[model samples]
Every structure is written in C-alpha cells, then in structure tokens.
Target: MNYTELKARHRSERENYASNALSLRLHRALSWLNKAEQVEDDDSKFIFLWIAFNSAYAQESGQKHYDTERERYIAFIERLVSLDSEKKLYNLVWSQYSSNIRSILNNQFILADYWRFQSGDIKENAWIEAKNKAMKAAHTALAHNDTTTVLSIILSRLYVLRNQIMHGGATYGSGANRQQLADCSALMFDIVPLFIELMMAGQHQVWGDAAYPLIEH
Candidate 1:
C-alpha cells in the first residue's frame, strides 16, 4: 500500500481499537469495580474486583516485551513523564495514586520473597525504593531470565497479585488481600491512561515523521 493509504489504515485501526476495545473494556472494568465496592458480600466483591484487576493487567502487561523488555518500557515511561510533565491530568493522577503505588511496593504479603530481598533494611522513601527495585529487577530479568527477579517488577506485582487472588492464594474475606485489590484498582485507574497516552504518542511519532500524521484527538 502507498504511504497515504497505509497511514489512513493505521489511523482507522487505531481509532477503532481505542474506542471499541480499549476504552470500552476500561469503562466496563471501572464500572464493575464501582459496583463491586457497594456489595456487602465479600465473595461477590472479590469476584468483581478480580475482574477489574485482570482487565487492567491484561492491557498493561500482556504485551510481549512488557515482561522481557526492560529498557524499552522504562524508556516509554520516561518519555511519557517528559511529555506530560506539566499536564494537569498527569499531575492529578500522580497526586491521587502516588501513595497507592507506594503501598503496593510495601506490601510484603503480595510481594513475598521479592519484597524481602529488595526492601532489606534500607529506610528510603517507599516509592523511590520500589521504583529502583523494580527497575533493577527488570534489568536482571531481561539479562538472566530470572523468574523471581522478573516477578519483583511493577508489572509483575500487578500480575502476581491478580494471580494470587484468582488462584486461591488469598480468601475472599481476607482483609489484607482486599486492601491490595483496592490499591491495585486505584493504581490501574491512574496508570492505564498514561499507558494509552504513551501508545498514542508513539504512533504519532512514527506516522508523523513519515508525513502521514495521526489525529491528536
């Protein structure tokens, strides 16, 4: 196909996928979580919570390189921060979920041995320490294919938490697991938007430079 035709196709596909699939799924997941919170039955709440968590996990970490590619995802995150540094939406998300992210980092039960290994006796900011450990784990995983190290990363934390709950590691009424689920839901709500924005930016960079630009909206 010609460049013009190819670009148009790309735009059409991206718009359809974003609107039809990504946005729809995200909306449904969030809606489910909202409804789930209202229920008094712990089993029902846990089931719906797991649905939301799995939805976010699939979108965020289902990519091929997400688990294996250290530098690529790190660079993507860095670029996202740089691009949206002054944007109010980004700042708002950060303000709301920054503590939630830290909580995920500090959760020993969810992280298990990975937590014991990385947290150590250091007394640093939880968020900073978590970020460092995740990055280091990513690097190690990419280099050595270490499952434990890979599981220590942020994406892995999200995935593992979902797995643990979905696979019966934690009971429905468990206070600790429920808190972790809530935190994951909040973190996903913030981080998913950033991931979508980064993806759009990457596509724009590619097609824009080729003289067939993507629509910003």
Candidate 2:
C-alpha cells in the first residue's frame, strides 16, 4: 500500500513483537528503513538509513562479555556454512554485497589506510587484503579490540559512518560528503532487508517455539 499505511502496519507489527530487545530493535530498524525510503533529500535519506543500519548492527554486534542473540545467529551461520546447505546463500550475500561493504569500510579512511600499509600490497589479492583490513578496523572500531576473523565488518562500517555523522565531524550534504551519504544509502538499501532477515532468524534460533510469531491480528 502507501507509505503511511505501510508504516502503520509495521508499527502494529512491531508492537506485537516488542516482547524482547532483539524484536524491538528489528522493528525500530525497519521503521527507520521505511522513513529512509520516503525521504526526498539525500541527506535525510542517509540519516534515516544510517539509523536503520545502526539499530540492526547494534543487535548483531552485541556487548562484550555477554552472550547475545547475534552470537547465536553467527553460530547458526557457521553451522549452515559448514553443512553446505547455506553455503550458496552466504556466498551470494558476500559476492553481491562485498563491494558495498568495502566502500563503507574505506569511508573510515584513516583506519583503512593504516591497515593497507601494514598488510602490504599484492595486486592479485587486493580484494582479500581489503577484506582483511576492513575486518581489522571493524573489530577495532566496534569491539574496541582486535579480532583475527572478520564477522560483520559490513555492518560495522555503517556504524562507523553513523558515529562520524552523529558526532558532527562529517557534514551530510554536498560534494564529497554527499557522495559518501549516497554510497551509504545505496549500501543500506541492499543490506537493511538482509539484516532484518538475519535478526528474524536469530530470534527463531534463540527462542525456538516461542520465537516472535509472524502474523497479523
């Protein structure tokens, strides 16, 4: 239906699913995504999309020293990848979205440059190295530490951009900043639905039969 009607329906759905932190966060993210879609200005779209990304990313990253719904989701992804049943899905996601992920990571220019310098350059392995550096920065930036493996750098970079904009270090409209906003908006357009799907999967994995029911009253 129309944007207003869709938003109202989503709000109702969110109210039904607000029993847990994860559900609440998912609904909030979706609401922001809807707003992002409706906004006319690139800057406004960027902010709403960033908010959407941040809401989902926070749920996925969780807090240090605590078992989170995201942890369970990761575990589930690991299992699926190992079993080959979900390998194609994972591969598809990576192949389709990895470039946008890298774009977001590179927006954290200082961190990205440092990682590139330290990692050394191999022309053939540029993508691999970029992924490595992005992962490193994601862990450092988000978890405030180091990680050998990259889990969610894509989402983490969005978080980084959100911080830059929210902290007033970066302007949202015009010139280079405008392009940055555009890039993030495009990336969010691709990933927001995926993030929502992942969160829904996590909810099911963590809550089993009691997972948030998907129905309308």
Candidate 3:
C-alpha cells in the first residue's frame, strides 16, 4: 500500500485494538474488585497495582521510539465520538480506560505514602510527579507522531485491563486472562504475606550472624 493508505490502515487497527482492549480490561477490573472486597489482605490489592503498573510501563516503551504516533489516537477518538452519539459506549470505554490508568497512579501514590511513613526519603510532591509519568506516557503515545501513537494506544489498552482488576468489581474465578490476569490476581494475594515472612527470616539471619547471605539466602 501507498504511504497514505498504510497510515489509514494502521490508524484503523489501533482504534479497534484500543476499543477491544479497553472493553476487556473493564470486565477484568470489575471481577477483581469484587474479589478484593471479600478478601482480608491489603497486600493483594497493592501487588495487583504494582504488577499492573509494571505491565503498563512495559507496553508504553513501544511508543518511546516512534514518531507522530500520538496524533492518530486523538483524531480517531474525536472522529469516533463525532460519528456516534452513543455516549454510553464512549463513557464505558473512557471510564474503564482512564480508571485503569489512574489506578496505577493511585497505587503509586499509596505506595509513596507508605514509604514516606516508613521513613523512606520520598517527598509527597515527588510521588505525584512520578505518578504523572503514566499520564505523560499516555500523552506521549498520543503524540503527533503516528508511530509512537500506535504503540502508546496499545499500551493504554493493556492498562484498561489492569484497571478492571484494581478499581472495577473483580473477583476470583471470574473472567480473566487465564495466565497473566488469573495467575497475577492469585499471586497478588500471596506476595505481601510471603514478603513479610521473608523479612522475618532475614531478621533472624541477621541476629544469628548468618552474614546476610549474598543473594536472597
């Protein structure tokens, strides 16, 4: 295809991908939220945010090296809403998508607060700045450069899924990725408890003069 045709095709693909992914993420997020409410562990919720944040960050890297990628998303969304008055779908998509994005930022905010409480050196403003990064990443994906926009759109779609688990009503054994989502949700519940045990073990080793074994001994 010619350059113009190629760009058009590419733009179409990205739009569809973002829509589908955002829809799926909403479903997943809702399920997880349901599960988290029933559970007694706070760590599970935190870990879900952390792992999802990492996942979102990983996907966004695709936009970093591209150009004119961000514009396509803006144009596409504008055109879509203009063509359809079906605000419900748009709201659903945007709510689920933006919510997922915000959840990671929220997670970071919470973690930064905890770290501050524990005497870590993070400043409150610094944490907000760090959280803003995800937004910047999304905006970067929506840049005028077509290439970067495409990549960022995909990353944004992925987070739509992550958001479902964090803020949406999610639950165990509900609809999930079967690998990443299902496994991650299960694993999230266990990580904090597991970490506490590890810390305890390390403390024992320190007192016993175990020499703080080289790596995770």
TM-score of each: 0.44, 0.54, 0.24
Tens-place lDDT digits, model 2, residues 69-158: 445445433433343433343543455445654565665442334335545743435655665766566545434321112334554444
lDDT (0-100) at residue 76 of candidate 3?
31
Residues 18-114 of candidate 1: C-alpha lDDT, one tens digit per residue: 2344443444445555665577655565466556534423433333334443344344445544455445334444365347655775666566455
The C-alpha lDDT values of all candidates are: 0.50, 0.53, 0.37
Clashes of 3: 28
Winner on lDDT between 1 and 2 is 2
Where does candidate 1 stray beyond 4 Å? 1-98, 114-153, 205-217
Candidate with the greatest lDDT versus the true structure: 2
Worst 10 residues of 3 by lDDT: 204-213
Q: Can you tell me which runs of candidate 2 are displaced by over 4 Å? A: 1-20, 57-92, 97-151, 205-217
What's the CA error at residue 216 for candidate 1, in Å?
29
lDDT of 3 by residue, 99-186 (tens): 4434433453233343454465766676566556655655554343333333243334334345545675356445333344433344
